[model samples]
Target: MAKSAPIDDVPTHGEGIRLGQFLQLAGLVDSGGEAKEVIREGDVLVNGEVDQRRGRQLQVGDIVEFGGRKARVSD
Candidate 1:
């Protein structure tokens, strides 16, 4: 099962957060480079869609999946 949290959107911040930062913070991929590779290879998903941008910004409620693990952003 994937871990998810309820997040509220804030006007001050962008709808999505940085991909590399999110992976690092979640302890998913070890390094930013690794995350980039995974993303480039279509190994990651954002909101149920394959996303290949390492710098892609994930929204507050967006779901991120990689390596059979998933997480949702929350406040």
Candidate 2:
């Protein structure tokens, strides 16, 4: 039973947002290029599963994890 990192709530200010943009919005990565590279390298997780699509549409309540950090989408 290891303690998981606290999930941070990030506001999208819309109905939904792309995974790449959200990653940067939550301060997970510095730039879109970095986000794409990491995402393609299988370093990003969506709700506990690896997702490679940077354009993946994430709605409210979607959980994204990367580099031991987690962020939940919010409107």
Candidate 3:
């Protein structure tokens, strides 16, 4: 099997965070507007699937990938 990309753990400030917000919190994007743009351009993934919903709720253990990097949500 091929090795998966490394995943960095990202802690949320609350119980959960929206995909767009998570992007910013994870330092994947510089701002919320950038997150929205990236999501709209199909540059974001959730749990290995392409997701375009900026408001998609993300919780612990959820994985997000962009720019060849992955981030795993942690409580």
C-alpha root-mean-square deviation, each candidate: 4.9, 0.7, 1.5
Q: Write the per-residue lDDT of candidate 2 for residues 1-75, one digit (tens) a residue.
A: 999999999998876799999999999999999999999999999999999999999989999999999999998
lDDT of 2 at 20: 97
Worst 10 residues of 3 by lDDT: 9-18
Which candidate wins on TM-score? 2
Sort by TM-score, best first: what order?
2, 3, 1
Give the C-alpha miss distance for residue 10 in model 2, angstroms.
Answer: 0.1
Candidate 2, position 27, lDDT: 100
How far does residue 50 in candidate 3 sit from its true spot (Å)?
A: 0.4
lDDT digits (tens) for residues 1-75 of candidate 3: 988888999988557789999999889999989999999999999999999999999989999999998999998
Give lDDT: candidate 2, residue 72: 99
**Model 1 Cα lDDT, one tens digit per residue, 1-75:** 966543323231444568877876776789988888888899888888998888887777777788777777755
Q: lDDT scores for all predictions?
A: 0.73, 0.96, 0.93
Deviation in angstroms for 34 in model 2? 0.4
Tell me which of candidates 1 and 3 scores higher on lDDT: 3
Candidate 3: lDDT of 46?
99
CA lDDT, candidate 3, residue 9: 96
Clashes of 3: 0
Cα lDDT, model 3, residue 14: 55
Q: Of the candidates numbered 1 and 2, which has the greater TM-score value?
A: 2
